[model samples]
Structure formats: structure tokens, C-alpha cells
Target: MCLAVPGKIISIHDDGSLMKMGQVRFGGIVKEVNLAYVPSVQVGEYVIVHVGFAISILNEEEAQKVFSYLQEIADEGGQ
Candidate 1:
């Protein structure tokens, strides 16, 4: 199954084009994500990431809920 995970944007890098990139933190893991889809995004914002792309911006409360659910799944060895 495919999953879109919630992560916080830590830093942003403008490539001088439409394709913007940033480092997103998922719990303790950080990965580069494409931010072009959400041009209004900024550092410290929460986003739903899938396949290295930030699909949508989410509020902090919603982000935390998803994180908690993922943690529960991990704790249950459901990965």
C-alpha cells in the first residue's frame, strides 16, 4: 500500500525556477521533497508528502494526528 506521510519543512532551497525543494522532517528522519506544488509553503510548515513530493499543506494538529497514528502502527509492527 502507498502512504502519504506528514512532515515538517525544515529548510527551503529555491532552484531559480518553478521547482522548489526543501528538507522535510518525519519524526527523526529527514528527506528532500519537492515543494513546487505548494508554492506558499515555508519553513516550519506541515505538509503531506508522497513519493518525494509535498501534495498538500496541513495544520499542526492534523499533522500530529497522522504522526501519532503512524507511531501506533509502527509499535504494532504493522509496517
Candidate 2:
């Protein structure tokens, strides 16, 4: 099964004609995403990213909680 991970919208850069490029951040890992489906996203907002597109928006606290959980899992695995 595929998963749409939650990430924070850190920046946006339109090409003056289309909403097709921007940056999203997940735990300091940044990636390019398609804004074609989500043309209204802004910085400081959380979004559910899937296959280079943002499918849905998430809350700030919820995003942080996800990161916290991942950190915990990584810590456990390292032990």
C-alpha cells in the first residue's frame, strides 16, 4: 500500500503561468512537489504529500506529532 506522508509547506515558486513547482519539508528533508492540484497552499502549513503532489492539508501540531513519533521509532531501532 502507498502512503501519503505529512509534510510542511516551507516555500513556493510559481512559473508565472502555472502552479507546478514548490518545496515541502519533512524533518529537514526537502523535496519538490507539484502544486497543480493544490494551487492555494502557503508557507507554514502542513500537507499530505503523495507522489510529488499534495493531496491534503494537515495541522502544525499534528505534523510535529508525526515527526516525534518517527524520531522515537528511529531511537528505538538504534538501541
lDDT per residue as tens, model 1, 1-79: 4699999999999986978999999999999999999899989999999998999999767547865996888889964
How many residue pairs clash in model 1? 0
Sequence-dependent TM-score of model 2: 0.65
Q: How many backbone clashes does candidate 2 have?
A: 0
Clashing pairs in 1: none
Top model number, lDDT: 1
**Model 2 Cα lDDT, one tens digit per residue, 1-79:** 4688888888888886665677898997999987777777888887888888888777667647865997899999999
Roughly what TM-score does model 1 have, to 2 decimal places? 0.71
Clashes (N, CA, C under 3 Å) per candidate: 0, 0
Global Cα RMSD, each model: 8.7, 8.5
Question: Once superposed on the true structure, which residue ranges of model 2 sit more than 4 Å away at CA?
Answer: 59-79
